[model samples]
Target: MKGNTLQPMTMPFRVGNVAPDPEREHAAPVRIPIGPEATLLKEPLLGRYASTRRDIDLDMDAMRAARSRGELPPFGGPWFGGMEKDVAWVNTTRVIGDASDAEELTRAEVTGRKDSVVMLDALREHSPAFKDGRLLHTSTQIGVRETRCLLGAYTLTGDDIRTQARFDDGIAVGCWPIDVRPAGDVGVHAMYVPLPYEIPYRSLLPRKTDNLLVAGRCISVDREALGSARVGATCAATGRAAGVAAALAATGGKQPRQLDAGQLRTAVRAQGGRVTPPAH
Candidate 1:
């Protein structure tokens, strides 16, 4: 939701395991499509609209073929049937894999819109899809949730994870999973939860850089904290904080850490950001 209008691309993998939908007992295997590039994974998505067209064509081919031959929800059978445990992961993968193309169509339909590459050595990883490449639908360019921290005056550390640190410089509040999209477009790193949290100004700081502030997945956080702050709602708040801090620093000729704490808190409060009262 970074408001990126990145175009979608569909590049299918070499192998596929269609979960035979018992209902469609007359159809053949449905080939699942590949995912888009993370670099290109932006909102207001543009460019790769053709990928959706190709996918629909292929999926139609698959559905027709499956129906002509007879297939059903899962075309494979027993294995896919008992895969309920992995449902969450599979469903999430569909974001960049299957539904992304479909979702892009919504851009043309509702907002209206547009599309991944396949992978080679996935089974080696401890991914849930590891059963001899049985149920996994990994991609070519692994999903990358974020990049550089943008470098700020203070860098957030791992310990700040669940402790719920506060700052007069704090500018946003967010709570989500430590969701890390994988390197190849399919696999991702995520932790389940943590308390509702506020992104510290430190998270905006790069190791040794200054001025620029970073928010979203690029924030400094622990493996767990990253998961918690990765959600869109959370990132948005973090972004809002960065924007305010940057503006203040640029206009006042003050560093982020040097800004008047009282003034910073007042500004953030004005924006509906929730902060804890000072601890005497």
Candidate 2:
């Protein structure tokens, strides 16, 4: 996230077949009905599914974050339990939505609370990493350090990685790198950034529906770029832009991608989205 301007959207991903992201080559799987897999999911949905919604009992916090591994959804954070030096269980409810300084809180983190469960994200993106029972001084801004992506229109492979790809319908831009944590996950196999790539509008389109627009990792990018394109902040910006694009088409009586580039970008900006060229 260094050198990149941070822009995050505050919208939740719509729900449907938003399976999750990355690892290996995708054959551009089409959208299919839940087949009992999407039901009872708690992980945040993204991409095309981000454009739809489903109701569930979100009152249960742990259930709110649960997801089965049927489709291998793209999600991260410390793996819970099982080892020493594990930084997965940092407690966050203590400071969410409040303007509190993390450094100060981390400086006095209490790991001796037997009644509380906590995690220490030491890389300094979310919670400070605890070292020697002392928290490491890190950015309190809480950033997403790992990257993973869903399947997409373009097939980005390891051989084709380390370079950027320009798509016919570039809807989003990427400058972030691909980083994975705790040795292995589905998508991350490296500790560096791959060449930035453009996200295609088709990538954002759900395979079967004409009315949905996926934002975030749910949108399409190959297993490689998933790590970069699926950044939460950027995904939010993309979601905002997609929402405006959908709105303009809905209000002015048009198709999802039927608007003029300038008009669409302008509408997105007017709706509080940030876009650069081709419409700047």
Candidate 3:
């Protein structure tokens, strides 16, 4: 992370789905679960006994029509994934498309709702487990994958992860692969990391903002590097580090940028974090 080097981090838009468990008791608030049982399927209806292709196609066609009418934003092909197997957890929802407009927040909201309904319809029609399932819930809001990233003390790049870059001030670690979705005709590409890479505390310190600290996908990272660090586990780790650093800085009357890296690392480790990067 370095100073005043804010970069644009973009990713394909996606939505998620959550369905009710047929075998489980109908509780007050419907539960949506996620686990290995949730398989990410490319074609919605083409899977074995889960043929809802027609529904998916119709949804896409309708979306395209909406886009033509300026009612919906442009989006890519339909994709679906959730806990579809045995009732191990509550079903969930996931949808992805193009939603880069900052001004069109309402448009994104509409698209997410439309996408969720279409996917839910498909799940109910083809999936035996959800034939009678009800839509217990939907996301209170849409999830954005990428946005404006702070220019920090250091800007992490994809090559840093590929080479297993280490840092003396490393405060967090990320091991997820560099998974990027195709913009248009380009296919989704994922490059695995052979070893975990250290995320420097510098990456979290904004250049011009002394008291502010950034965690999660907004940390100082290039778009490619973001693919790996954007996972939940990594975000949690960064959040822990930031929280500790913020507390220490506040108590000591120091700016976040002025906190000592070693002290921060010690505090993070005491809270069950892995500060040191793994061996190459």
Model 2: C-alpha RMSD to truth? 18.4
lDDT of candidate 3 over 23-112, digit per residue (tens): 543233332232223222233222221221212222334444644765433343333333343221221222333335454555666666
- Taking the tens digit of each residue's C-alpha lDDT, what string does model 1 give over 1-280? 1212221222222223322223432223432232321122222232122121111111223332443553321111001222232221221222222223544433322211111111212221223233333434433333334333344455554345455666656666654434433323221223333344456666675656566667786677654455456567777877777788888998999877666766766777898876452232
Model 1 regions more than 4 Å off: 1-91, 94-143, 150-158, 180-190, 276-280
- Which of candidates 2 and 3 is the stronger one according to TM-score? 3
Please identify model 3 stretches exceeding 4 Å from their true place.
Answer: 1-102, 122-134, 185-194, 278-280
TM-score of each: 0.44, 0.42, 0.64
Ranking by lDDT: 3, 1, 2
Which candidate number has the best TM-score?
3
- Top-scoring candidate (lDDT): 3
Q: State each model's CA lDDT, in order.
A: 0.42, 0.39, 0.59
Estimate the overall C-alpha local distance difference test score of candidate 2. 0.39
- Candidate 2: regions farther than 4 A off: 1-161, 181-189, 194-196, 269-280
Q: How close to the true structure is residue 199 of candidate 1, measured as C-alpha lDDT?
A: 60
